[model samples]
Target: MINKIDKLKDPLVQEARELSSSKKRIFKNKIQLRGLEQLMWAKYAGLKIESIFISEDQNVDDYSGFSSPTYQTSNGILKKITETNYLIPCVGVAEATPNNDDFDDFVLLLDDVKDHGNIGTIIRTGKAYGINDFITTNDDFDPYIPKTIDASRGTAFKVNFKRYKTPQSAVAFLKEKGYQIVATSPYGKSLQSTVELDKKPIALVIGNESVGVCNEVLEAADHIVQIPMHTGVESLNVGVATGISIYELRLKEVLTMLAEKIISSLGRKVSVTSKLIRRAFDIKLKEISEFSGDQIIFLMVLKRKSQMNEEQIGEQFGYFGDRLEKFISPLYENKLIKKEYEEIEITNAGEDLLAKLWPIHEKTENILLEGLTAEERKNLKSYLEKIQQNCIKIMKYEV
Candidate 1:
């Protein structure tokens, strides 16, 4: 952001640049905490503290029992240090790195997810669900985005993340080290059947919201499962879906892990169905955002009606899926059209959710296929595939 040469006081980035080197051990540990809110939040959030910065005008007496090196800087000096044109009286810098787990149990893989809020929410969910140690693509959003940072409730500081230039590299690292890679796809096998939950040590890769996972990334995954839908809603918001998926997957993994342990150590498989159900409820929250699946169905139908119908919608259920009820109940509850209904309409909510459904559905079907059950999903699949083939043909034809 401070790209202009003149805008920078130490335009060379000498401090950050110098700190970039592993030497300067003392300086690396010397984190300067500035601003009242930063200090308060950092303190409350249990982040490590080395020192604090305060402006002369602020009420010093407000903070009790907190003492550190206090430096008096001119308004210009404070502005110069953080290297921002916009001035803030305070900020916090902590010389702390969050602990990274190896994720011997379960972890979340970020494949070039470049949105700041999305990354932060992903991290927050990872932490919430007892997942740590991210193996993410090099181009993924910075975990330290101010919006991400705030959205994460400071949990970002507590997460351990390593970046890889390609998702393949990360997958290789995890696989060679022995971890199952689960990729999420709307068109993939149903979640319930695809994942046994009884499997131990898995990594779930959440891709870009718009394009989903790249083909290379998808090929790298061990299994793919979709968040099943009823009516016509195609996908869930990346953050919301990521939270639900991680929560469901990890908890199930944990229980299955414990079951495996009990089976091994105690020579018995312990049943935790009740506990699993409760955990699933708490995590797979009903945040549909749309009024009904029909709302979503109406949109997808409006988008691809010539290609799909209700019979195809039924086949998706025949596929093993998770959280399908969460998405479908409302549509069924409201009796909205699912590509088969005659009267069709798209509400404001439907339009909004539809914008997030990217890379289209037929592409989804061809990418992840099972034998066509009743010809409805098949018809939709065929329609979509033909359209895509025609588009490719035309593009090549144009050339």
Candidate 2:
């Protein structure tokens, strides 16, 4: 008669069982990466591997960093590892534990946000807006899931996130120490209301899209804020609303550097309330009409396109002879802007220069743009749009 337990008798399984029972171990800790489980007993966890295992024998060492384990299995171990005739060989025993501390800055707490996409997009938005820390209710979608990581587009590694069995406790801790707790809700006040943000510290909270913030946490929050919606649209996607909110807070409160965004959003036209630094740049030029730098008077146009031809420049500033050219030329030559085919671009040099004299640029750009490389922004926006679609896809059912 065939043995009922023959499969379990493979020597490889025997080895794993034996090691699992051992006690001696060593580890490293008491530092920033202060709470890792695998490292807690690195000696045993590190060396207890029975043998390298693989489903099928093939080359996997193209990038050895992701390769090493796939290449070192004995023929006996291979058969035993593959319980089924079809092999299933990849295995490692690192305990999944959230022992990371770098998640303190602007941590996002997701309270029962059920949709996986919403969770993913919120994470992407947090990363975009220079927020690198997050905490989720115990039931929030799994951050370690491959789909969630894919949604983050590598941002998962940059940010620190942990799952909390509860967010109410986190809220209480934050409120006690003066962190502003703002919640998202249909019933919240207008979006443009002034937020008194402290440069010292702050936290913005988001709730489940379906039911809104829990009453318990809602009562616990310092304030409940909302994003104003158009008459037709019901509400913003949790992720989109979060991105816009964070954008406003970071650009306005975090730093005053990006005056252009405020200008750009006010309809491709420039505004008159000149940034303090720009006023300083052309302080003397205000005397003449051609150089009439009435920053306040012209709310519609701010900087004349630097790349404009003499005619275009003349249209904005009355064409003047060599004297005026000498004056306007400096604005062009400094690389604050460029004129080509009558178009202009504010260069990095220009943006930095604007940032120095004004404490605004660093805070505005750093926090609003967050740590997003240019490419990441495109991917994030695209991903957010995709998430919005999936949400809408699901949302259509409710409507």
Model 2 weakest 10-residue run by lDDT:
24-33
On lDDT, the candidate that comes out on top is 1
TM-score of 2: 0.46
C-alpha lDDT of candidate 1 relative to the true structure: 0.60
Score every model by TM-score. 0.55, 0.46
Q: At residue 168, what lDDT does model 2 achieve? A: 75
Residues 1-399 of candidate 2 have per-residue lDDT tens digits of 111123445564454323321121001101111112221222222222223333234344421333122333444544443333433334322222334654453667778887666777888788877887776665333553334434655354455655566777767766665566777677876453465544434577778888878888888776677777779999788888888878776655545334544655633332342354346434533332133232222211323233445554455555557854664565566655565665545456655554443343233334555779999988967976886698679978994
- Considering only N, C-alpha and C atoms within 3 Å, which residue pairs clash in candidate 1? 34-91, 35-90, 35-91, 190-320, 232-297, 293-331, 312-376, 312-377
Cα distance off (Å), candidate 1, residue 13: 12
Model 1, runs deviating above 4 Å: 1-35, 44-47, 63-67, 98-101, 139-141, 192-194, 263-399
Model 1 lDDT per residue over 56-76, tens place: 555556654354444433455
